[model samples]
Target: MAVNLPLPIPENLTAVAGIELGHAEAGIRKADRKDLLVMKLAPTATVAGVFTKNRFCAAPVQLCKEHLAGLRPGAPIRALVVNTGNANAGTGESGLAKAKETCAALADLLGCAPTQILPFSTGVILEPLPVDRLVAGLPKAISNLKTDNWHNAALSIMTTDTQPKAASSKVTINGQTITLTGISKGAGMIKPNMATMLGFLATDAKVAQPVLDRLVKDVADRSFNCITIDGDTSTNDSFIVIATGTAAVEVNAIDTPEYKALFAAVQALAQALAQMIVRDGEGATKFITVTVEEGRNVEECRKIAYSIAHSPLVKTAFFASDPNLGRILAAIGYAGVDDLDVTQLNLYLDDVWVAKNGGRNPDYQEADGQRVMKQSEITIRVRLGRGDAVSTIWTCDLSHEYVTINADYRS
Candidate 1:
């Protein structure tokens, strides 16, 4: 087991006083372990969410996609239900019914329509959920809800994750402080289609739903959707933003520089949380950054970057502290992009120029690459010698434990 490292929660998150957190140990996967989460948003709040693009997505994702439309400019979501240890995917019609039932139950508690509640699930796939356990745990969980239990809420929704990932940020909007708190869970099977993982971000800002939706989608495209781990998108991916309108800032629209500042803050929060997922990746000790620049187009740049990031050989090499540059070169060559010209390629390992003009630099040394790879984090720069388009992708090393864990995931 990896040693427990201190996960410092981000700064400036105490401003959102209206939001509440609730979780219960449903015994769905293991006895005496929490596995259910409910987040309460204030009425009159605004909400926006993005879901997975997979055709076989979970029932909750589909439900959320439809319900988020209801949380318009003045409307808001009442509750969010997240369950771990059972994805509730591939269950066909029954799963859809259960998702609706959970939403309806929460709506009843909150005295709102069923369409106002959103449900999300993660964990094992294809198994019918033990709805009894969830129901039995609901009342107790609701009673246990607290305002500042951010850490516990992050922990309760984890599956195969060594540590809980949570991030917070405080931004000043019209001189009023707004707090953003988010949590995510993905140790394996992560390749964000929307969230490409399970993440929820809540804030006390008063942004309109349309603005929030557009900003959330743009941020997700550059952050969560850009990263890869195993390149297998899950059936239960979700990312949501809830604005409680309690910040007391009457921010009008997204056209001004202040709006740009708030948007930047939200994007930063999403990127921070997304990086946490990779840092605590299943069996990962090193975080790798892959940058592909000078591509003919944005798509080609990302294609090459993801190909290198998702390459098992590249990941294992990173794990072993071996800077196998040849594997990276080969990955880019076969990224399904055209224009093969290694002579124009430039490479760097952790910012140290290593490859130049399709050949190893004279100053490159095995010790240099090994030293760079030994750091907890690394960056690999690949200049494709095409246009100026560039993209950065984040991932983690692949270790034997990764194989061991997935090999016996169901056993």
Candidate 2:
């Protein structure tokens, strides 16, 4: 049995009515269980996605890219096939063929073009996918697709994840309301090159593919791209959004207040789901939020934030709940950003100021710092004393359990 992680569904998903979602127990990796999910989009749905930059990306990532490449401006994807327990990465040409076959199977079931179907997989690496298992599971998943199965769909994507992640939000535009729901899976290998994990956000709102594509990229940058777990990015990381246009109201650009609100709702949903991934990070006990402010630019701030997030010393210190300010400071010093000034730096733990001007604060107390560390969630704020730029990043603590889980993962 796998160790269960805290998987909670985010509120604000009940606003959309036309979108139907569901999952089936395919018994792909485990016997007598459901591990495959099928998502159907209403006819003529528009889709937008971001995929991993890893050269060794999984077969599904390649398949998704091919599907999205064929998408027109207004047409929507027909279906999505996702499975857990085998990444299907690095299996060479056979993996590619399996991915294409999976898409073809889904297309055949939905009576749509193969290029209109997308597939994603996450699990052990380098193993050839049990294509028979997935093929056998397709009919049940398609037959069982429904509107209220978001929870089941969320759980079907889990691999080593201890939790099922979901988020939802609603926005009103042109006197018409739209509902958005999302599900994601990730834990162990979670440093996103293009995307950090497997994410799917869907809405009944009608929007053009161009607008959806732009919005997905913007939101993904601020959410999925801002998180870290083990510092190793997966070959399977990808995020996708689908629009069914069931609401009957069409919007062209994100200029109006209503459109901005819609964008905010989507961004919130994505960020909430992304944070959930980190909170349930494999073997994670504490959640740390790193905020870098006063940098010369957003890129510089992100550099500082990611450096601290991916550092083993910083993560382990978080696990121990030790206020090891030195490790954080050191990480900032080596963040590889241009025009950094260490002399004018300031650091804070939660609301308590710890370091100032490259040294310990005169009023800093070890006991006070320890008090802050006792919480399962913590915030580290850094002021570079340069410009007004800011960036926020999330990560989980490093622990021996994380190593143990991965060391014996294949066994």
Q: Estimate candidate 1's alpha-carbon lDDT, on a 0 to 1 scale.
A: 0.82
Model 2 whole-model lDDT (C-alpha atoms): 0.83
What does candidate 2's lDDT look like per residue over 1-411, in tens digits? 112334454443353455566577777677766689988877757788898889998988988887788877445577888888888999899999999999888888888888888899888888889988899889988888887778888889987777678877777777777888888888888886654479988888777778888888898998898888888888889898777788766756877665577688889999988888888787888888999999889999999999999999988987898877799999998999756778799999998999989899999998888898878888999999999999999888988889998998877
Q: Where in model 1 is the C-alpha error above 4 Å?
A: 1-5, 9-15, 70-75
User: Which 10-residue window in model 1 sums to the lowest lDDT?
Assistant: 1-10
Q: Which lDDT value does model 2 have at 271?
A: 92
RMSD of 2: 2.4
- The residue-by-residue lDDT of candidate 1 on 216-275, one tens digit each, is 888889888877778888888888887888877644577976678778888898888888
Residue-level error in angstroms, candidate 2, position 182: 1.0
lDDT of each: 0.82, 0.83
Candidate 2: regions farther than 4 A off: 1-18, 73-75
